[model samples]
Each structure stands twice: as C-alpha cells, then as structure tokens.
Target chain A: MFKATVNITLRDSILDPQGKATHHALQNLGLNQISKVRIGKLVELNIDADTEEEARSIAEDACTQLLANAVVEDYEITIHKKQTVS
Target chain B: MSTTFGIIVFPGSNCDHDAFYALDEVMGMETKFIWHKDTDLSGIDVIVIPGGFSYGDYLRSGAIARFSPIMNEVEKAANEGVPIIGICNGFQILLEANLLPGAMMHNQQLRFVCKNVFIRCETTDSIFTRGLNKDQVLDIPVSHGEGNYFISEDGLKELQDHDQIAFRYCDEHGELTPEANFNGSVDHIAGILNRKGNILGLMPHPERAVEPLLGSSDGRIFFESLLNRVVGA
Candidate 1:
C-alpha cells in the first residue's frame, strides 16, 4: 500500500474571494497583522499498487480527472512507500 | 423545432428553477435538469451553469463544484463549441472550469450586493447576443458577494484587443458610467465571451427578470437572442 498527499490551490493569477473574506474576518477579530491569505484543499489517499511508479500514476490521474481543476487551481502529489512488518 | 438545453444543478444551486423557467416559459425551449453527479452530456445543445452556493460555498465558491462529475461533460461540450452560459455563481464556476478568463473576487467593500444595474452590450457577434446592437443598455439584476473581476493588465488588454468583452456597465444613454459598475470591475466589465464567442459568463441574473412582474422585462432580450440563434441554426 502506498500513501499520497495532494495539495490544491488557486492559480496565482486568479482572484481568491474566500481567502479575501477570511482575511477580513481575521482582521475583524483583531488579527490585523496578517497581510495576505490564500486558501486551498488538502487530500490524502492510500493506494494499493504493485510499485511506487504505479501508485504515483494513479494519484496523478485522480488529481487531474477528479480532484483538482487545472484551470484556476494547481495540485501537487507526494507519495510515500509503506514499510512491511517483519 | 424545439431545441434541448440542459441546466446543471449542483447541491446548493438556487437558480436552476429560474433558468428552467426562463428557457421553457419565456423562450419556449426544451429544458432538462442534470444533476451534478452525472457525467453524461449527451443530446444537449446548450448547457447552463446556474448560480448558487455549490457545495455550501466550501473551499471556494465553485472549487468543489468544479470537481463534480457533470463538469467533465460540461468541459467536453465547451470544447465542441456548444453554447454555454454561466450566471452569477455560475460565472465563478466557469472561471474555475477555465471556460472563461479571469476570476471573481469579493466586492471591494466586502459585502453581498443585490441590486439592479445597467449593462452595455459590447459585442453582438456572440451566440448569446447575436442580434443585439453594440452599446445597447440592458437593465439586469446582480446579486453576489464575489462579483469583482480581476485580470492582469496584459490579459485585460488582450480581452480588449480581441473584443472578448461582451458587456460593460452603462447608463440609459449607453454611456460608460461608474454608477452602474457595481463591483468595481476593471474597465466596468460585467460580462465576457470566450475566445470562440460561444461561451459566456456574466454576473447578472437575466433569468430573474424575464417578466414584467419581476419589476423589469429588459432581460427578456437575452433569452430571445439565444432562442433565435438556436432556431435559426
């Protein structure tokens, strides 16, 4: 079994309305030190695959096809190999 | 000939019924309601991304909706040059889908604004407004928290150079007026058409003003224009 973590965020050029709203909320709560706020989604998956390469391919396909929107958002995948019990 | 148009319904979509009514009652077009979970896009000539707080406005306005199964079909239809319109929150979804340029940010004042405004038709060459005259003012209603459009200077120039800007706020005399520009949009832009001109995304709710009972019937022209195009083709 392989584990992967995916991070998704709006493209730098796109405006982030939610982030801006949150920033204002923070300031309203007296957290005025924050200059900028950008929000994103984090997803983790466990894949059963024969090899690390196979697991990575599956994860990438999921991100592109279903998980992340390549237009306004970008995603990164990090895979870790699981160790077996002796 | 009756043309079939599909209105996509996300979980929190609030404008699906309004869209359906406008197309069916006003334009006399066949309409279908497609769930966001469905991945099929067969037999639909026009697909509408209705306005609403999809996925409860989680992550972002249209972030989660962009991953719904129906978007895959919507994407395919857009590539085939099928007509598509996204209104209000639907406009945000199109940006998330990259069907249209630029993204919607919160109002400069950080408030949810709901009001009637005037929009000048910038181009009549698009499938959505083919018969309209340039610089014509149409009174429409806008209601959204995130309607401010942001684009880089180069991108803005590109849109201008290509005549992709479909609508801008204007006064009764068809003069560009900031009073009608509700969201502080760059260049007073209120709507835009894609490079192919078949896809359009606007922040106003034309569907909400199709009848005189709704206060103003000026929005009827939008549906009439699209209906005429579909019938003519």
Candidate 2:
C-alpha cells in the first residue's frame, strides 16, 4: 500500500478572498513582516500499487481528474511508501 | 412543435423545481426532472442545469456534480445541437465539466449577495436571448456567494473577439459602470455563451422572476423568448 498527498491552491493570478481575510487578521495582530498569504487544500489518497513511481502517477491522475480544478487551481502530488509489520 | 425540457436534478439541487415551473407551467413547455444517475435524454429538446448548491456545493460549486452519469448524455446532446442553459450553480458545473471556459470565485465583497440585478443583453444571435436586442437591459435576481467569474486575459480576448459574451452586469439604466458590476466579474460578465452559442451559463436566476407577483417579471420574458426560439425552430 502507498499513500499520496495532494496540495491544491488557487492560481496566483486569481484573487484569494479567504487568504486576504486571514492576512488582514494577522496584520491586526501585529504580524507586519509577512509579505503575502495564500490558502490551499490538502487531499490524501491510499493506493494499492507495487512501486513508488506507480503510486505517484496514480496520485497525479487523481489530482488532475478530481482533487484539483485546472482552471482555478494548481496541485502537487507526493507519495509515501507504507511500511508493513511482519 | 413544443419544446420539451429536461431539468437535471443533482442531489441537493434546490432549483430543480423552480426550473420545471418556469419551463413547464409558465412557458407551457413539457418538462421532466432527470435524475443525476440517468443518462438517457431521448425526446428532450433542451436541458437545464438549475441553480442551488448541488452536492452541497462540495469540492467547489459544481465540481462533483459534473461527474454525474447524466453528464455524458448531456455532452452528447450538446454536440447534437440541443440547447442547454445552466443557471447559477448549473453554470458553475458547466465550467467544471469543461463545457465552458473560466471559473467562478467568491464574490468580491465576500458575502452571499441576493438581490435584483440589471444585465444588458450582449448578443441576440443565441437561442436564449433571441428576442432581446443588444444593450437591452433586464432586471433579474442574483443570489450567490461564488459568482465572481474569472478567465485568463487571452481567453477573455477570444470570447470578446467571437462575441461569445451573452450578458453583462449593468446599472438599472443600462450603464456599464463599476457600481453596476455586483460580482466584480472580469469585463462585468454576468453570463457567457459557448463558441457555438448552443450553450449558455448565467449567474442570474431568471426563473425567480417569471411572474409579476414575484418582484419582477422581466425574467419571464427572458425564458419566454428562449422557448420561442426553440419552438420556432
């Protein structure tokens, strides 16, 4: 078994209302040094695959097909090998 | 021949009944409520993707609903010259389904704006607005938190060059001003048409105003006109 993690976020050109709101709240708390804030989503998937490469490929397909919307968001996929107990 | 409509009812779609009433009762066209899992669209002259949060608006407004079984049939019908109108949430789904370009984001004010809005008809070449002349303004109801439409600069130019824009948010007097753009959509776009003009995705709820008793009846003429186009063909 393998685990895949996908991170999806609004494209930079698109405005992030939630991110801006959080940034404003941070500024109100005197966190002035922060340059920018953007929000994103994390999606995890468990795959039955033989190798790390196959797991990563499946994860990417999942991200493109369902986890992320190409029009408004971009995504990255990471895979982890699951350790089984003997 | 009377035009029959198929209103796709995805789980959590609240506007399915409204669309049925608008097209069936008000417009006098035959209408059916098609379940999301159904794929057959035989005898349906047109299909409507109504407003409301389908699939609880999860994973984006219309994202998950795009995968519903009926979508394949919807696409087949669309390619066969069947007119399809997606209102509000339906519009979002059309975008997610890749039937239309661009995406929707939260309103610029970050709130669910529910009120009467003015829209100027941009093109009468399409079936949905065949009766309205260019620059004609209609008062329609808009209620959504994610109606702010966005597109890349190049894609926007393509839409404009092809006159694919169907309607634009405007003032009551038909002026295109910043104050008139309620959702902050690029180019004040309130609705758009596909390249072939057989598909329309609009954020406003025309069904909500199909009767004088319901605030305004301008939406009545809009649907009435669309039906005429379908019937007259």
Candidate 3:
C-alpha cells in the first residue's frame, strides 16, 4: 500500500469567491500582512500498488479524471512513502 | 414517427419530471424518461439532461456523473447531430464531459442562488431558438450554487466569431449590465452551444417555467420552438 496526498486549487485566472471572502475575513481579524488567500482542497488516500510509481500514477489519474476538474482546477499529488506498513 | 423527447434521469436529477411534463403535457409533444444506467439511445430524437445534484455534486458538480455509463452513448448521439440540451446541473455535466467547452465556478457570492432572471437571446441559429429573435429577452429562472461560467479569452473570441453563444444574462430591457449579470459569468453568458450547435448547455432552468402558473411561459417557447423544427422537418 502507498499513501498519497493531493492538493486541488482553482486555476490562477479564475476568481475564487470563497477564497476572497476568506481573505476579507482574515483582514478583519487583523491579519493584514497576508497578501492573498486562495482556497483549495486536500485529499489523502492509501492505495494498493506493487510499486510507488504505480501508486503515484493511479493517484494522478484519479485527480485528472474524477477528483479534480481540469477545466477550472489543477491538482498535485505527493507520495508519502514507498509503501505502507500493514 | 413522431419526435421523441428523451429526458435522461441521473440518480439525483430532480428536474427530469419538469422537463418531461413541459414537453409532453404542456407542449403536447411525445416524451420519454431515460435511465442514467441505460447504454442504448437508439429511439431518442432529442435528449434532455435536467438539473439537480447528480452524484451528490461530489468531487465537483457533474464531475463524477459525467463518467456515468450512459454518457458514452450520449456522446455518440451528440456526435451524430442529435439535439441535447442540458439544464443547470446538466450543463455542468456536459461541461465536465467536454461535450461543451468552459467550466462552472462557484457563484460570486459563494452561495446558492434561486430566482428568476432575464436572458438575452444571443443567437437563433440552432433549432432550439428558431422562434426567437436575436437579443430577445426571455424570463428564465436559474437555481444553482455553481453557475458562474468561465472560458479562456481565445475561446470567447472563437465563440463570438462562430456565433455559438445562445444566451447571456441581461437586464429587463435587454441591456448587458453588471447589475443583470447574476453569476459573474464571462461576458454575462448564461448559455452557449457546441461548435456544431446541436449540443446546448445553459445554467437556467427552462423546464421550471414551462407554464404561466410557474410565473412565465417563455420556457414553453423554448420547447415549442424545438418541436416546431422537428415537426416541420
């Protein structure tokens, strides 16, 4: 088994209402130094694969095909370890 | 044979019945309800993908549902020049399916919006709007949380050059103004057609306004117009 973490975010050119709202809220709370606040999702998964490379590919496929919509979003996957201990 | 309006029902599709009723009862046209799992679309002349939270709008609105088994046949039908209209969530699914370009984003307010909106008919080149004149304003209700439409700059230029835009939210007087743009859509676009013009995806719910009791019958005109083209042919 291999563990992976995926981060999904709106494309740079698109405006994120939620992220902008959050940024305003932060400013109200006195976090004025923050240049920007972009919101995104983090997905964690454990996959069963013989090799880490295979698990990474599977995770990427999930992101592109289902987990993330390529039209307005982008995704990145990172493998935690070579394999998970039973 | 009479024209058959096939309404595809996904697991969470709530507007299928409305669409069916609009086509069958109100317009007195032939209609059928199709299951999402069905792989064959042999007898259908027109396909309608109605709105609601398909796959619970999981992963993304219309992302998971786009991969449904029936979509393979849907794509085939679209390529064969079958008229397919996707409303609200159905529009999201069609975008995710890549049958239509661009994508939907969260409403500018980051909240679900449900209300009546006026849309300017941007084009009437397709069978769907032959009865309406260009820039004709139609009262349509759009209900969705993720209806903000976006497209690349080049894509918008191409859409304009090809006359693929079908509808754009506008003021009651048919003026394109910031106040009338409900969802912060690109150029206030509320709907568009594929390059071939057979496939249409829009954020408004035309089926909901098919009767005067629903506040307006402009939506009825949409269905009526399509039936006219099919029956005339």
Best by DockQ: 3
Residue-by-residue lDDT tens digits, candidate 3, B91-164: 99999999999999999888899999999899889888877888899999999999999899998999999989
lDDT of 1 by residue, B131-157 (tens): 788887898898898888877687799
Chain A TM-score of candidate 2 vs. true chain A: 0.91
Please provide, for model 2 over B107-152, each residue's C-alpha lDDT reduced to its tens digit, 9 standing for 90 to 100. Answer: 9878899999999999998988998888999999999999999999
Q: Model 3 clash pairs?
A: none
Model 1 steric clash pairs: none
**A1-86 in candidate 2: lDDT tens per residue?**
88788889999888998899989999999999986999999888888888899888888888888778888899988887684623
Q: What tens digits encode model 3's per-residue C-alpha lDDT throughout A30-65? A: 999997988999999999899889999999988877
Clashes per candidate (backbone, < 3 Å): 0, 0, 0
**How much is A17 displaced in model 2, in angstroms?**
1.3
Every model's DockQ, to 2 decimals? 0.21, 0.71, 0.79
Best model per lDDT: 2
What are the C-alpha RMSDs, in order, of all predicted structures?
4.0, 1.3, 1.2
> Which runs in model 2 stand beyond 4 Å of their true positions?
none
Candidate 2: residue pairs that collide: none
Chain A vs. true chain A, TM-score per candidate? Answer: 0.84, 0.91, 0.93
TM values, all candidates? 0.78, 0.97, 0.97
